[model samples]
Target: MSYDRVRAVDEDVADALTGERERQNDTLAMIASENHVSEAVLEAQGSELTNKYAEGYPGERYYGGCEYADDVEELAIERAKELWGAEHVNVQPHSGSSANMGVYFSVLEPGDKILSLDLTHGGHLSHGHSVNFAGKLYDVTHYEVDPETGRLDYEALARQAEEVEPDMIVSGFSAYPRTVDWEAIQEAADAVGAYHMADIAHITGLVAAGEHPSPVGVADFVTGSTHKTIRAGRGGIIMCDEEHADAVDTAVFPGAQGGPLMHNVAGKAVGFGEALDPEFKEYAAQVVTNAEVLGETLEEHGFSLVSGGTDTHLVLADLRESHPDVTGGEAEEALEEVGIVLNGNTVPGETRSAFNPSGIRAGTPALTTRGFEEAEMREVGDLIARVIDNLGDEEVYAEVAADVQELCDDHPLYE
Candidate 1:
């Protein structure tokens, strides 16, 4: 609950909302997949449009009085198409996972094969972890980066594609720090006649701003979250060539999700508008720059980083090397004590369980949105390293909390 932002809610509602906002304002948010959306996005998301339920696609509808909802949703769809240079766009998957699932539905049958990156090595669950629907319904073939260098082995990936002849080859990751070679993946997929999907949720903003390579033209299907880098509402979108438009749209509408959230669609419009601005390009560039500096700072402070360093906004730290006794979860909790928030993650070949893995994933998107720059990120990196180093020491975290407060004070959000 963010008290400072919501005035219309009752006392209790305001109290809850304001509390969350206050925490967000105070904390250093380094979670790789998180970001603070603009105020306009928030306003659109919580607008009166939520009161209506307009099931079906933009122009075609199942219910009466969907005129305005149709306009809003259509605007969102057009904006998405313009933003990503996609021939077709479906902005109603509810989440990136859902969007991935819809893409699967569009391209493959239930028992078809899929080749995706290994989950523990950086791929998302939707790519085909055992517990996910992708793994449950499909014959999933896993690929891994070179264990020695912690980087993608395109040659090995091509070899696997040739052997498996998978129905689809997913090229993306949730925790990877290096830039993906979309063209390489396209070649790999083409060699085996496999469909290609790029889950660019984390890098959508970077791609839009030309800070990262765009998968829009290269991938057969591109899926992403509106919130992470795009700084939009909390939802997912699917982009593809004109060839797959009908199948993808059907998969999202009657095939998977019910009616779209008109309110969130409105929010998506606001975010897309913001992303189209020139300043968003500058912001996206700074996001990657801040992350690289922070990653270096963490390495200099004795933390072992995944893939040596980050070329993107995320940095995955292997805490096992620097603090063998402290698990990722422990380090996460310790950092929270000092108002620094980040998620524990699994590193490649991690011996520990996923719930308490050996790595912590951090990023600069949220802090950059909060107006922190490269210098602040370096200081944040140092503070994060200190917190992880002294996990069980209460006095140490307390002292670090003071330092965190000072930093936050210097770069206060929403003042």
Candidate 2:
């Protein structure tokens, strides 16, 4: 983790890197999609495999000197399969979006209809939001969570599927706090003869650890980010049955991406190997418990939780009710000033702009990774409530920052 070599060559970049590490060491990273990887994963990602140009799969590379690259990729693929019980796993996609793109290219033609959860209701941009390439290429429609329950209504979704008759139906979410019923979505997809793609970008580790129901067998395709709930470095993965393995591989290789980031693949390998350990299950379970504790504490402070509470590592608080005058952006700013970091997220039935939405999404994955348990999470929640309750109080901000530093000190990372 030292920057000595970089400092000898480029002092400015080294300083920036050192500063970032310090900042992480100092703050509580509560971002729903972020986690601190182990030093093993970090070292693998920073390894010399970055220079490789293996253009094809293991044992079938187009270039020479790819033995190491092939070994790394194969290990990553095998570990991922073991972690997710996937019939076929592709660790080559550069990002979660890239994995989704590979799946899209493998089957659907341009303008094919896609049915997914609405973006404001916890869907990702790659699920066919107009701003993304998927949106531009595909004909996209959306389903919404029940406004009253703040959860998906399977019957309604089925009705919608029957009405739209989309070529594909995407399950899973970004800010949702409840466990998904993969079978229900699959039944809908089956009725309509549509492909079901479950995007577990936010809960890969939970699914792998059996803390959440997996979509591997029920859904036609599964895609996820390696760096989220999983303590892997930055990467994406795609899983499908053996029937679509060739199509998926071909799409990922020459159709969607050229050369894979082999260093990241190595990181994925190490992270996946770590996840296979029995202790990782305990870690994943703690992540959910911490999230539940955080959500319960926030609720006791009058914050409105989307879906009422969490079954995974994150909680989506709709600030529109409890703090009507305060926007998510304002709360985000104040929280960051106190060294607690998360995101301003859009909630269902959003009435505000996307940038400054009506909700704040807090997660415990990173904090749990830092060795925080229920008690620490509860105190963190109280600190967040204090900040949002007194946004402009400088004295209060200083007090909360001091407490955050104490927590960071107690649960040291990268030591």
Candidate 3:
């Protein structure tokens, strides 16, 4: 990961590249949306396929010299179909946000009603936030989790849907720690005569590996990011029934983007092929187990978890109940100073601003990817609690940083 070849030409760019690689190798990556892809995936993404400008789909092209590109894209689409059990798959969207836009372009009109989860309540910016394109183009309504329980109240969602009939309903979340009821959300969308789109961006790998319930057959549209839990290249994918295939393909290509990222599609093909192996399922299972251990340990340290705990690979802890004096930003900084990396997130019924909120979201996907187990997670949790308990104590931070360094040394990354 030195980027020696890059250094031969542009030393400045190579320095930054090496710096990033070293940063990943040294620190813990607890961000729920982040994960380390395989070296094979990395090679596939940095291939000669990047030179090709494939403007169209397989068996049909807008330019000449697309034979190899067709082979790569076709394999990607077929493997994605197998992994997700979708009748059709589109692997050309540039990112998860792009995939969402494709579905909206296919079925929704300007001023159409969109019902999605609230951003501060474990939702993504692409799910109709005011700053995003979806919010500006569509009439948006939001649903929130139960403030007391910190879990989704599907009955409340159903009542809201009935009151404000929408064109589409978006499920899936960014920082949520529990399993979703795709069938239940489908029922609400069905009762309201709206399409259901589940953005499994964070759990793509888990669902593909059978660690989580799949929304492929239940929801009208399923979108995911290939790079998250899927451990692939950075890109987006859309899955739907054959009835909506053409609409999705057209919307993705001529509608939202021009040329597809063929190299990333190749990487997706390779990564999805690896996921079909039995080992990937075991890895996915360990991710959830490690998260459970992490949440349990944090709870033992007097931290309050959203939804009580996690059934997935992430944990959301509301600092307001546990560390009333320390904000999420302060906790994040203290942890980062000790080489423990995660993010400050807004909790359900949040009273703080989005920039620096009252909650911290952590995950086990990357840690499990680095071969960490439940015991290692418990040790890590103890270190996190120590830092939180002594936020301004320099001696505690120094000791924790040394311990974190030892952990990083034991479980080396990208070696």
C-alpha lDDT of residue 282 in model 2:
99
- The local distance difference test score of each candidate is 0.89, 0.95, 0.94
TM-score of 3: 0.99
Who wins the lDDT comparison? Answer: 2
Q: Which stretches of candidate 1 lie over 4 Å from their true place?
A: 1-13
Off-target runs (Cα >4 Å) in candidate 2 are none
Q: Write the per-residue lDDT of candidate 1 for residues 3-50, one digit (tens) a residue.
A: 544565477778777788788888888898999987788889988999
Kindly provide the TM-score of model 2 when superposed on the true structure, using C-alpha atoms: 0.99
The CA lDDT at 400 in model 1 is 86
- In what order do the candidates fall by lDDT, top score first? 2, 3, 1
Model 3, C-alpha of 11: deviation from truth (Å)? 1.0
Model 3 per-residue lDDT tens digits across residues 152-246:
89999999999999999999999888899999999999999999999999999999988899999999999999988878789999999999999
TM-score of each: 0.96, 0.99, 0.99
Pairs that collide, model 2: none
Whichever of 1 and 3 has more TM-score, that candidate is: 3
Which of 1 and 3 is the better model by lDDT?
Answer: 3
lDDT of 2 by residue, 8-84 (tens): 99999999999999999999999999999999999999999998889999999999999989888889989999999
Error of 1 at 141 (Å): 1.4
